[model samples]
Target: MTVTETTTAPAKIWDKAGGWQGVGTAVGILALTRVGQLLMIWWLGGATSEPRSVWDRLLVWDAGWFLRVAMDGYPHGYTYENGVLQGNELAFFPVYPMLIRFAAAIGFTPSTAAVLISWIASIGAAVALHLLGTSLYSKRAGWALVAICCSAPASVVLSMAYSESIFLALVAGMFVAAHRRAWWAAGLLGLLTALSRPTGAAAALGLGVAALIAVREIWKSENRIAWQPITAAAAALAGVPLYIGWVAWRVGDLDAWFKIQTAGWGTTFDYGSSTIKFLNTTLRTGDGWVSISIALMLLVALAAAGVALTQKPWLPLAVYGVVAMILVYGQAGFYHSKPRLLLPVLLTLLPAVVAASKARPRVAILSIVAWAAFGLWYGAYLVTVWPYTL
Candidate 1:
């Protein structure tokens, strides 16, 4: 019996080391969680007489902008209709639209392509997140991280026509590459990520930090430094500026990107004053459960940051998460969407998972399940109740 147990333990270790077992489990969890989201949405819609088709439901708000961009390229200049300045496709990033266009070229409608791309990218994001979590800790932590990510309150965006999944997949891939010291892969992934979303620049920052770490290690050893690190660092730092510069050139203003975001969509960076005002107004008005939910989300983000500081597991991840939160919450616009914005900064969940793991086994399972249940409920609320610009 002892010999049989010893052999089985080695087999289990080998299975984990092989990588497929953990990834398969993570993907299964992701798929099942998504099904739960679908069922909840369907049931709620039926009960409330909302009766929205799945495609129609997914293509709301920003999804329309992406579809417009894919079907019709950016306008030449500021588009005004009947003396009112209308938001143009230029405000949206190019990578997602390009993907939509490619799918359209192959005979898929823009809307179908958008949903398809988002779902595929979501799966990729989950798998990549799993890989990154495993690389950072153990396979168990990897699975736990996936649970947090897939069930996030705003993770419904992952199944929509938004760039979140694309950006997340690339971000996770960049970090995984950085961890493996594959500088070229990290650099290229970071470049693509920068094209996907403005926050992609935060991922680049993380990559640059990783490169700096590699440099220090090289310095510690009396060995020759590799060109990979330098190239990766340069690429990571340059990708965002290059995209912003292109946008500026197109609009014929050096600060056109910021101008478009501000003038077109009312999104501007006011150094947190707007956020403060928003919180004050929400509190004063007593917006009920939604306000409480948003406040709780803010607390979760802060707690994650605090836990990361205490654990100090990975500096790049810590920096990436901190910067992402700053960008999400410190910005002036779309206060209601702040929780959604913070969804991609997935490292925030690591501390919670770590804490859970240290607890008694049944307690840990119950707590994690409760967290996931709350996430699912909150996500359902975002989709059904009090519509915000998610």
Candidate 2:
């Protein structure tokens, strides 16, 4: 598959699982993790070129493009700087910018509003993840999922002015809706998710697969058919194509978006050849810490995927995690970003954490501590020494 093709729940059981209190605890843990990261940044003198305050450092890298999009919509033509084409605003999705624009229009600077949007979305995502995990397994597993997410090496991106937090929250919401069999709600949330990130197609595919299995089971058990769920399945599958069609119409080419991604960012599909080359280069150099860190994260992802296969999480969640991982690893460009891209595969880690916790609570807690420590170090390294996109 090409770049466009490759890129890539549920709740309830309310009172029994501690409900909002569980969510609150999970968010609190994530917030504290963010605080630790902030302190690390402060101790490291921040990542800005001129030494600005830590609070002002959130708007770097892709955050700048998002802020520009919020402040001054998408440009009609491509942009270039010093003879090289720059990333276009059209490559970014609209939902996060729309929220930032709304927040800025009220009373905040675009920078402040963008950070606030990310922070709030991070908490919301924590809550949604808690609910989804609890509904799937035990309350312990739910808490474990939150702990793993908040401490993952890329979790710092959750607190930055990026769309990962919002995408995570919306995708978690879709999972809950699917679990509850609220087909329309799941479809609508999946649509919103697609509008937030290119990986949204993974969620749509997972939900559509789940809906099909549901319909099959119904057919096996009963003599009746349900149109609402079928409609929901169709709606869920439609979002990415709709957005791509809009892009095609705007640029007057069916593969305009893919070409833009390739030209602007060097992103394309090479069936893991790029990843293999990156790993080989890093190993041969013996100094590329960034490459080494990304490689370690990829190893962890493979382990998590193995755990998912062995543990057998809900079919939809399992499918979503696997597909998301494939998209992340299958991409050709930006090998350093593999860790950040894998952030959406939160479900893949759930089974591993839960199994560890169930078999040995002490070891699980120790692993969580180590994970958080690594995140703090890597997060700071990304800003301080590496100068790579997080």
Candidate 3:
């Protein structure tokens, strides 16, 4: 047997995931998990709960802008009914709706296109996770990771017209390529992930740093300087300049974006002792009792996954896990949905899978099932109910 097959991780992880078997499994799981979310959106679409409050209100975050961009390319006017600004619409990235608009231009309804794209992207992510997991751990760990990922409430994002599903797919896929030294593929995926979300920079940075280290270790080889991660980082940084320039042109102020966030919305990025403060405040909130509990649990699960992750054959995973954790909960804000925001950081699962491979085969399977149940249920509630009203 070859190294991968004879060692621990199964050959399936590195097998051609685009093959019929991978495609079939990936498609099957995506369909089953996303059904609930698609049903909810289909059921609730165009239905009004109250005159002032429509289905859009329940959607919240970038969902409104997605629907708006779907209906209208980009509204020229601004409105501020809630505490957030409108018009500039910089809070919502352009890639997602750009796809929606492309679909609408070609004749697909925005909602329908969103569902299809998200499901496909989410399935792609699961396959990436599976490969990365099996490579790092055992075949069983990889499968378990995919199982948990599919069942987790985050699976619901695949149903909505949101960027998270696509974004996570790119993020996880890039890391898989990166771990295997597939620099060009990693860079391309990293670039896409960056364009898809604000945290794209973080993803690019992780991959780029990992690449630099890999080169140093493989310094004797001329082909080791793969520019993909570097290129991806540059592309991600490009978004900031492009976005800021647009904001400046619109408001005629150099700092228009920062000003809008503070003045128009009641948000300020102050890094005090606030991670703790946010947690303390959250605990005090009888308002978000369940949300607060879920948030804490996600954090705990991540930490547990980190511990399990570091035990793997790879050191890069441990490094990535440490930095990712610091980057995640390090924020000093108290948004009830902050845990969900860290969804793309699911790259941690790649390394965690490898670490988990050390477990006895039976025990590993048992552990995976348990984590899968908790993750799916916990993720489901977080996406559907908490942080947003029922």
TM-score of each: 0.91, 0.91, 0.75
Total clashes in model 3, counting residue pairs 3 or more apart in sequence or in different chains = 5
In TM-score terms, candidate 2 sits at 0.91
For 219-285, candidate 2 gives per-residue lDDT tens digits of 6667567565677767767777887778878877787778778887788877778887877777778
lDDT of 3 at 90: 50
Model 2 CA deviation exceeding 4 Å by range: 1-21, 46-50, 80-85, 359-363
Error of 1 at 134 (Å): 1.0
Ranking by lDDT: 2, 1, 3
Clashes of 2: 5
lDDT of 3 by residue, 1-390 (tens): 211322211123245642324444555555655554444444443343333222332255657667676667643334455766544465556677787778777888776676567666777877776666655554555665666566554555555557777887787777677666666677677767767765666676677665666665554455465454456546644654675566577657786666555554333455535566766766677446675765575556576656555444354444445555565565444455455555556544554454455667787667666765555555444444444521
The local distance difference test score of each candidate is: 0.77, 0.77, 0.57
- Candidate 1 is scored at a TM of 0.91
In model 1, where do residues sit more than 4 Å from their true spots? 1-20, 81-84, 359-361
What is candidate 2's CA lDDT for residue 198?
Answer: 80
Scanning candidate 2 in windows of ten residues, the lowest lDDT window is: 1-10
